[model samples]
Target: MFKNAVQLFEIFGFKLRVDPSWLLIAALIVWSLSTSYFPEAVPGETRTLYTVLGIIAMLGMFLSLILHELSHSLVARSYGLKVGGITLFIFGGVAELEEEPHDPKSEFRIAVAGPLMSLFLAALFYGLTRLAADGTEIGLTGAVFGYLALINLVLAVFNLIPAFPLDGGRMLRAVIWQMTRDLLRATRISSRIGSAFGLFLMLTGAFAMFSGGGIGGFWQILIGFFILNASNGSYQNLLIKSALRGKTAQNLMSSRVHTIDPGASIAELVDDVMLRQGVSFVPVVSGERLLGYVDTAGAQSIDRSEWGMRRVADILVPASPENTAAPATPLDQVFKRIGLMPRRKLMIVEGQRLVGVISLSDLVHHLALEQEIGTSLRG
Candidate 1:
């Protein structure tokens, strides 16, 4: 829902991107107060007082979310992760770290820092209420400040719910990683835990919804849906990480490849096509070097079906730079590229000669193999 909110300002060199959805939340709060809370209070005095308190309450919440995120960003930066920015959204704020923490201690520090700051803010607000020194009746100022304090407390506890994409989940991942010494395995375990939490929240929300409890139940269902989606994404990310581990193209590349000469008799070349090299295309080459790849369909432009076209001079497609992959490239990067260009194939090459080909099917097969290995390892 965010637009261009990072333009808000720079806070200690950290950029902020407030999601546009936060405005929707603010609107909801105001509407809720006008319809429900405002109607019950005394007319003139209560209205003016609460109007100011409501504004203060909203501002306090925003400030609290920002402080919570700042705790995370500062710790993550100290530990060497690049803090991209902090985003304040409908639910809460998120500190965007460029990468996962390097160790469990670092992760635990980063995760706990947010909640601890929330607790501190809560305490600070409570202290201000008690030490007012003016002995003013616990009116709008007291009520709003008290409510804001409680909000921070609730935010802290709720975030510690041990669900992925949440602070607690990351802490869980960090602990498990420290124990198992395998990040992928740790991620898998934590994702499962988050997914379970999502299911539980969904069931609870569904029960609340079907009971006709109205707005509160509807909100529960909304939160449930968010948790469910986030958990599923976490699980998929683990699967991707698992498939990519320790994989090198050299181990799976095809060594036997066909090549076409830049200049050859078209009639004789047509005979090579009839032999069936088990590939739809062959790279055009000159003296053990690559030029480009040629397809049989292209040769048909010169009546190659009857004339037997052999020369790849103009028949080959241009060799694209992006289509090439290194033998030791990471599977995560490879898989990401494959999704962007489903029909594209990687030309695995050492120097000049065609080394192998990595197609969509190859990636699929690799994943299947990884699953089998994972199952075996677990067993």
Candidate 2:
């Protein structure tokens, strides 16, 4: 979902994206509100009116989500962290920070920002609802605003439940980090708590289902599974980042990289380069200037018959800032950059000159070596 996200807009230098999966949530919200929520709240509204109200309410909720993520991005940026972007996915939105927080205080501030924004939105919507209701306007618009107010408040409260990967969970981790002065330890503790909370939620969901809670129970189950996955993923990511901390791209990059000329045919790349060298990736170059790269995956995209006709340059993915890492870039940061790309690889570059390449395999090997050394020391 993160990889497939489509950029919607840029807000204050932070890109806002929506994953295709988010469309499911949007559709569900519109369906639920139009069929049941608005009809019940407004009482005797036409089907068309209810549909419009539902759409407006869903958009309002989306706006609230944006505000929530925006607040987090702004705070993170204020603390000298890069806000990679915000991606709205199945559960909600996440503000991808380019690096971890430098301290517990920064983490706490960033984590708390989202819920605070939600709370503020809730109050604003409730106030507007009141203003509309006070003037004898008890219609679809008023009900929609009222629903938005309630949902935003619920969002705020749900996010504050001290579950890892959630806003509240980060706050919990921050507090633990502050206390222990160990970020990894703090993360582990928070993740364990989050996993437990997720299990509890799942059990509650099952109970609710048995008690005839219907769709709401299923929703709870879905949320619980999401939280569980997120908590586990958060811990694993921190582990990877921790292992690679302070290491530079130069330290781990495969300097003995294979290269293919821009004029080389894709067929030659496959037979003479990839097959002969047993290398999956090779840089495309013209003398000292780096052009891009070609991998087996890219090669396979061309029909075997057309491989002889296609130039390496034709299939070479042009080097972008995202796909290129400087020698001085932190290894973990390089990993982060590469993960955002489909190829899961990065070209090491200093200016236009290609130096080396790094792949997910390199990262795994480096991490394994670190663990081995740690184990030896402990032994």
Query: Best-fitting candidate, measured by lDDT?
Result: 2
lDDT of 2: 0.89
Q: What is the lDDT of residue 259 in candidate 1?
A: 70
Candidate 1 residue runs with Cα over 4 Å from true position: 1-13, 20-23, 33-56, 130-144, 175-186, 249-323, 342-344, 349-354
The 10-residue segment of model 1 with minimum total lDDT is 34-43
Which residue pairs show backbone clashes in model 1?
A: 266-308
Error at 322, model 1, angstroms = 4.4
Residue-wise lDDT of candidate 2 within 262-332, one digit each (tens)?
99999999999899999887889899889988898898888999999999988888888888989999886
How far is 277's C-alpha from truth in model 1 (Å)? 8.3
- Please write out the lDDT profile of model 1 over residues 1-379, one tens digit for every residue: 2455545777878888777888888777666554455344323465556566566678788889999999999999898899988888777788877666888899889999999999998898887766642464545556666767788999888888788767888888889989999887787788778877877877787888788877777777777777778777766666766677677766665666667687865554555752555566666778767777666576667765545434567666765667667777776677767566534566677677677777777778877888888789989
RMSD from true fold, candidate 1: 5.5
TM-score of model 2 (CA atoms): 0.77
* TM-score of candidate 1 to 2 decimals: 0.73
